[model samples]
Target: MSSAHELTQEQSDRYWQDGFLFPLSVFSEDEAAEFRAELEQVEKDWLAADLPLPLNTYKRVNAHLVIPLAARIAQDKRILDTVEGVLGPDIMIWSAEFFIKEPQTKQTVGMHQDLTYWGMGETPDQVTAWIALSPATVQSGCMDFVRGSHKNPILPHTDTYSETNLLSRGQEVAVDVSEDDKTHIELKPGQMSLHHGLTIHGSGPNASNDRRIGLAIRYLSPGAQQLVADRDYAMLARGSDAHSNFVPVQAPDALFSPEALALYEQVRLDQSKALAEGADSAVPLYTKM
Candidate 1:
């Protein structure tokens, strides 16, 4: 894999200006196809299960085991190089999520910074690599971002659905922003978009006939700390001693090889220690609007 040290000056500058960047063909078509097959198998297994689904089933419904195909892509030299360039040498696979937009599904995500969900401190170092496992188009609810929103103050967020919608989990309503200022991100299979953790973004509902699936891999800088007292979400340290609270999911080993695993284990241990020390001093990063 190429080292993060090799990013061109232009690539680095673009990321700083745009708050997001799309790198073409990060994965080969063949590699994407294999991962899609694995995802399908997982979905089938979930459907055949007899137990009642969890309350957070929509978020936890997808299986996250690092299939061999995905593992290979996660370790791709080019990806590692770019991510390292943005986040620095020491990093951890913070989390991975499968965003599956079913056809005709009217579930739109509200415009908000990722840190709003993560509950981490405001720092420009964190990065998220969102890979398109299938063709992602505007019709299929492709992602949208406020071009320079990363430079703006973090906005309040709310649930994407209305009170009438069945999936409402009482998520905060997103702050209003102008549509004219947003940029749509459309990608073909194998392409990926990398964004800052504080970038203001969201997606529309899938109105197309096919499913729009994206695998988002989140990365944290080496020194990022975790807040343990916060029960609603996991927070990563970035600025001062404050952290942002985001939903914490189990780390998947498939995404990390032996070398990555070693780094992840060390970070996990350190995070545990920090949580233990600050067990009684957790604070909210934002207030309700």
Candidate 2:
């Protein structure tokens, strides 16, 4: 892997200590704009066709499976290099989702640890790379992290299944988080942040005039496995995966190709089985807007 964009020792230490690091320049402004345009164009075309599932459904889970642009971004060397600094040479992309908060929307992601419902146990090998395609500021609902919270064991969570919550289960940490404990991470377009899977974090509603668009790509090492599910899929973004804990997948050649769409459907259904486990509500995840 290229060392050009790898995280420095101090940066890695900060991440391990604080559970999150932000404002890493991963893409140029022009490049980020191009990616945003591609995403918006896909949204425009798909929405016009009036697909049975909502547009947000496609954006919320494994978007890289069907969107070539998303796949390319997920496998970008700059991203992989930085990821490798913490996860070692071998890294697998577990999932990628576009978390979009439209202007003046009530959509909020309550304070929660991601691993609470992922069924992945308390593994330290997993990290989430959140790339900002738009300005992520306080008004744009930028994520807030509780420093060193990843050190805690997986905490209790209550599923809200709220219409305005963006989480798969609308889950939140059972404990109240004080505002003073939070570190609001703001990023400009083309910048990114990395947070541990066990990190306690959340974002409020987008009150800005423009949308807050972020592409969150989950990465895991070769040793990671899905204990609760029969099978799981991932794309090897870095070195070889000797463990083969996850089924291997290739990047799509075209956006929403017939083959890609079929694969995405199968992945969506199978993955939801794990994500929705033990949920109180029967409402399927990534199925509604």
Candidate 3:
């Protein structure tokens, strides 16, 4: 629970230049353990379902119930201070998604920038922080980024799901990079990596006999406008002057303190409202058609 004021200038430069930077041990073991337990509970709930696509599965993948834990981590002074140092104090949590690679599930997240999904105007201030909840290694499908790829123009690629069961889709298009220029990010639990939204990066498959779970949170500067068409999920700020385009899913009261559990309830309500209103109308930047 350290303050978020420790982001150094070197780290900022590294992120800006390379499009990604890894900070080791950002979350303490206790915090990681708490999240692990919460995820286990979520998994249990998912396993009890008989549907082809369990409701919890989709929710977990889309970062529904995980808001409580993510909010806790995002609000930690240490992380928040760093975010402020980089993006500023007026900020909004853009989007959160879980990349879970189960044992023997060979899925490679194709190389692409996160901004492509949001269809927003480009800005260097937008970044996505992927927090490793489990050990991420080459054998367990760690993420790999193209060195200096963020400096290049955005390239087009076929957008599809990461896997077709247990192997990659086996489709590759030529990009202006070599194998020698790629950097594999091997992270242990509690470690995290920050990357520019336009960074060209992808992950390997889980060849090992374990699951690889990572939580990704996207943050935007306070003034960054929401270019995405749908606005149902967008919550208008009621009290704060934070004119952010990204909506706050976790309740303000539960953002910190004794009644944190109540935040999840609010998130559930918000999610339900978004669903009833059909909020996934954001235009995709790329399509395979």
Candidate 4:
């Protein structure tokens, strides 16, 4: 196998020091837009069927389970190779989520590090690949990160669960960060970025005329343990699961088939409960309405 997917020494070093690297071309602009069009129709059907996106946030968790393209994309060589350069070859896809910022929406996520309540064990060795299915510009609520904050202690977060907030718990970092030091992650369609699990990042509302859609896929090393007692699942993408830290999951046979949807629902509910562990407000897995 070729090592072309691996990151350069400079790219690797930048990630270690800054907690993020961005705007790397993974797909052509045309290819990404086509992918977006295909998934957009799926979302419409999902919405019409009353099983729309996740409820408490602007997320569609584990799209790979019900969306075939997403599954294939999860295994995209460019993404995996680059990730392996940082996380090692034993990779496990913990989850794939769609974070959609609708045009002229009031939804906004607060500055907070993930892994806060991920229940994904102590080591924040997890990396999230945020791929732009649409243009992820500053005007369209692109992600913003606090430089070098990934190495800091786990900051306190308060669950607001506000209606307009895009986070599941509407969680926000309970500390002040210097705005002057913030790094904006802007990507054209087909481009992607990677960020450490502890990176303090968030985005604003979509004020542009067009929507901003991104696939925030979480990739982890097999060494990381799942902390949720009743729920543990992961799909190995490369190498052996030597530690057996997570319950192995297989790929779905068909999109939205009875079997596939059933499995997807169960896991998502389990995840939502885990996320709502210490949440102050109601955090249902998806919208009840």
Candidate 5:
């Protein structure tokens, strides 16, 4: 195995100061391609099952439970070490989502704070590790952050529900973000970026000829609580979940196995309920089986 990635003290400190850090090398380009190939196969299967293909596919939700590769990737020792530097040793993977923009598409992620759409508690204890599966350039909609914006309280937002908007509620921050203050978090395949939950960020439509793909894996300390009045689920990605604050999830061995699907359904439903409970804006309807 290759050497795992770890944050230098400078990198970790810079993350807290700027609210985001990028280009953390995790896997080799060849390894990233392998993962991307696996995901392509998963997408094919999803299409065969008549699942949604456009936008950030909900197939990415709790994907570790449904897709074996995603599971293993989430538990990667290097990733855990990187996250540990920011969130400590006791970590739980609260969520995972795929942000994929096809070549020359108008699918843009609206500028918004993640907590606006997430019901995962008031404290900003979560960090999302965005692992790039393909090159993410400015033209390809690489996410950019408003430097130091994470220091502010959660800002007011509006739900546009635009068809091409990639937020859960199509939400955008109500306050104006200074264009000059933005930090474009560009990355090559196999690189990753970590951003705080309260960080103001979003991406534009992919105008380039290449696809942009990223796996956003959200990690939180065990002590983080759900803001909603409903139970939530998370996989204990590393260390012990001493608080028992969330329902536990186990890794799966096959793609969409019956056991995995059943667990995923239960967790997603509970999470969706929490999302609905705390949401002040309109939520996109999720089709239940």
Candidate 6:
């Protein structure tokens, strides 16, 4: 019998067919509130400190490396079980980022495929588990996905790098996306969504009164490899990583530990190099936030 956390066969089938699944329950509302509290506390503490980089830079990239709370959530069994149902037993976390849109913020993510800039090729072994710490509604600018877009090869993307765009390169699919083509993915606090790496997806600005907070953890199969960079970092979330495709990442024992910060910087710089390759404009991922 499958575990309670595993997705049902029907659900798994739907995910494969649609290239995405949504509003999967993982944390309870109370538990999600606790997580949000912890994240906000980290923000508050960082704002008061003399950190070399802006807090938003860490939030956009791999906050899990420096934040114990994010690391814990990234390795949560409930989330992993669901991912395992799709990607199988062996799983590696490519990255974890906190995508937070403040109320009334105009920063938007242009519709784009996740694997387009990763240099991971057209492989379908990657999945992104986006867990919401706050309500993600249409009014709040929840993600909108193009159904069955994952099956298509990586499409050409334009690097707009617009200041109002949330993406580092403002990469948008070269094809046009009409209103009828989008499926709005709305979620309550504590719920999550899983999408294929090639799935064409993006979200609008948060117009709601509250901030829209979502932790997007990218999971990869052990067989997947990064082609652009000589080195890649990942944390083995479950099963055995027989392929040894990426450098092992250790979970932080304490928030913002010295060791963790160093690791974060190393991973960030290396990943940035891969992402910015062949780009027409400056990549904003590692820049001052």
Best of the candidates, lDDT: 6
Cα lDDT tens digits, model 5, 1-289, are 3335667789889999988988799889999999999888877766657433222244446667777877788889989989988998899988777778899999998888887657764575789999999999999999989989899887888877788987766778998877797889999999999999899999998999988998899898988888763788788988898899888878888776777767776776777776554456546543253
Stretches of candidate 2 off by over 4 Å are 50-52, 286-289
**Model 3 CA deviation exceeding 4 Å by range:** 1-5, 49-53, 56-67, 165-177, 230-249, 252-289
TM-score of each: 0.71, 0.96, 0.75, 0.92, 0.92, 0.97
Against the true structure, candidate 3 has what lDDT? 0.59
In angstroms, the error of model 4 at 58 is 11
Q: Candidate 4 on 57-157: residue-level lDDT in tens?
A: 22366777777777778888888998987898888888888888899998888899888878774475689999999988889999999879888877888
> Candidate 5 overall Cα lDDT vs. reference?
0.81
Backbone clashes for every candidate come to 19, 0, 5, 2, 0, 0
1-289: candidate 1 lDDT, tens digit per residue: 5544355778778888989887645777787877788777756654555423321232321223223343344556666676776876654455556777888988776666776545455766578888898888889988888776787655665443353222223233366778787788999888888898778877888999988888877767644544432332222222222233334333345532454344433433433332233223221111111
Residue 42 in candidate 3, Cα distance off native in Å: 1.6
What does the lDDT come to for candidate 1? Answer: 0.59
Mind giving the per-residue lDDT tens digits that candidate 3 earns over 1-289? Answer: 4454556788777878898888645787667767877867756755665533344333343343233555556555555566655676555565556678887875777666555545455666577778888889989989888878888664654423234422122223236556677799999888888888778887778988878888887776656664544431332212243554554555334212334334433443443432222223321111111
Stretches off by above 4 angstroms in model 4 are 1-3, 50-59, 286-289
Instruction: Write model 6 residue lDDT over 243-283, tens digit each, in one string.
Output: 88799998889877778888988887788767887797667
* Better candidate by TM-score, 3 or 4: 4
Ranking by TM-score: 6, 2, 4, 5, 3, 1
List all candidate RMSDs to the true structure. 8.0, 1.7, 6.4, 2.3, 2.6, 1.4
The lDDT of each candidate is 0.59, 0.88, 0.59, 0.80, 0.81, 0.89
Backbone clash total for model 6 is: 0
**Which regions of candidate 5 are displaced past 4 Å?**
1-4, 50-57, 277-282, 285-289
Worst 10 residues of 3 by lDDT: 280-289
The TM-score measured for candidate 3 stands at 0.75
